[model samples]
Target: MARTYSLNTEAAKEANNGGKRINETGKYSGKIIAAFYEKNQKGTESVNIMFVSESGQECGPLNLYTHNSSGEELAGYKMLNALMACAKVQGLTWQDTPIDLYDYDEQKVVTKTKECAVELQGKRIGLVLQQEEYQKNNGDIGQRMVIAAPFEADTELMAVEILSRISQPQALGNYMAFIAKNPVRRLKNSQASQPAPRQAENPDPYDDDIPF
Candidate 1:
């Protein structure tokens, strides 16, 4: 059976993510379930991505795009590039293709389409999840685990400590070793600064009360 893909153009579910927050902040091995490019009416371009562990769980349909610029590239593109680099080092190749985006709201078969690095679908990669705060409708600080970094999936996922510098993932080409120097701060979401040892081998394994 083919996996169903939703563009999720609606404002993300904000109330405990509509009670679907089953993951926590930590590292997880997964694949790029989907990637797409979109330009809004404001003429802002974005690359949206989704991730999941084939064995269990899912995250995102998160937009990796931002107006935060650094030199010739946007920070979001660098994150996407790092994901691509991770997969490429694992022998995944790429090509341009179209993605069928479904509109599940109106009982529709298909309501939208877009071209992207379609070849990236299902490519293995690693994600470093970090919790961030968002204001709830009740003015409470809600937490969500976000993809903070992408590393090569083929490496020992347990030993993945140092996420590469935005300028370095393509060069280091592996998860075990890093660029070994100061990180170039290109984006607010990711800076090559290493993470502390994971409290669990796998972060949230889906409890009924998962924060994110």
Candidate 2:
């Protein structure tokens, strides 16, 4: 499909120093919405808003950076935002009115997430939200993050696109399982590497059976 938002050659050149990535090529000056998904060691998932594009091309996959504290990646959000920004810039709106979420199955397990609907030159189209983020802030306290992604789309074309671009379920599951198993080994290794505790310098003072 033809993209509504065309990458600004000049801006992209400046941004990438002449080498532009695929997703960046579609991003232009517009509001780029992005969502992030974070999976902790215990398989708990969190979503968070990663960015709202101000100018220039989208960050592409490279935009997904791993935060030092949480070690979560944000690339998917970058790409989605870029695509949406491009669609808006192109003056496209959905004709069929795509649903906000669509159901999909991975290995017979169904899932869903937010989706984007747009019409380009009278052609109805939709982009599945592969990921999203919901941000939260507490009073003089701290900020929290949540992340989610669409696992399905309404059309076969969109579904194919998503499948080709996103990671497969089985692969992701195996990887997560692998990570969960390694922590135990790591804990054991860490404990084994530490020095034993020093013995008490003085014996129990309460001992009364001393040989005279």
Candidate 3:
């Protein structure tokens, strides 16, 4: 017996693949859409931020070693200071108050005060995108983009006026063509990337330990 099925070509051609697209390495102004903390082997905290470029393309899973949960004075202290300073550029403010009763006068009644942490989402920032290349254990060349934390005087800052300029959508047409050509692969990839009910691990994990 032969089984027949109907094919809806137009519908099938709109599927999405599981491969997360990375932005081309370059300086750009972007908005942080998501952020979270991931711990390393030594229990150090790294801030992971997902950015969407002005072009409206998702570009990052940018990792910055900005804090130490252990608080033992690790290497990232200076970087953390810079990050805190940069918070001001994003319209964030810091509030400080004396911790001792002796230091506080009648005007200040509280013993302690605290500033809000950087709220990255919906904030725009300028970044220097750098590309690093390494040979994998399998002898494949692996390339990745990273934020070149700019602290030097020579670091170029994108002008404030231009930061608000609109960017054309970068991938819409090509993406449509990609789905048209690889519809079945896209469908399979998407399905495989979703987590199953009892599975704890990611179904389609990338090779690198660091989330791009």
Please report the candidate that would top lDDT against the real structure: 1
Quality of model 2 by C-alpha lDDT: 0.29
Task: Find the 10 residues in a row with the least total lDDT in model 3.
Answer: 196-205
Question: Global CA lDDT of candidate 1, please?
Answer: 0.52
Model 3, position 134: C-alpha lDDT score = 46
Sequence-dependent TM-score of model 1: 0.51
Decoy 3 TM-score against native: 0.42
Please give the RMSD to the true structure for each candidate, in Å.
14.1, 24.5, 19.2
C-alpha lDDT of residue 147 in model 2: 18
User: Model 1: runs farther than 4 Å from truth?
Assistant: 1-22, 66-72, 89-111, 135-142, 156-212
Tell me the whole-model lDDT of each prediction, alpha carbons only: 0.52, 0.29, 0.42
Residues forming the 10-long window of minimal summed lDDT in candidate 1: 178-187
**Model 3 C-alpha lDDT per residue in residues 147-184, reported as the tens digit of each score:** 54322112222121112221342222333343344322
Q: Output the better candidate (1/3) by lDDT.
A: 1
Per-residue lDDT, model 3, residue 6, is 93
Clashes of 3: 0
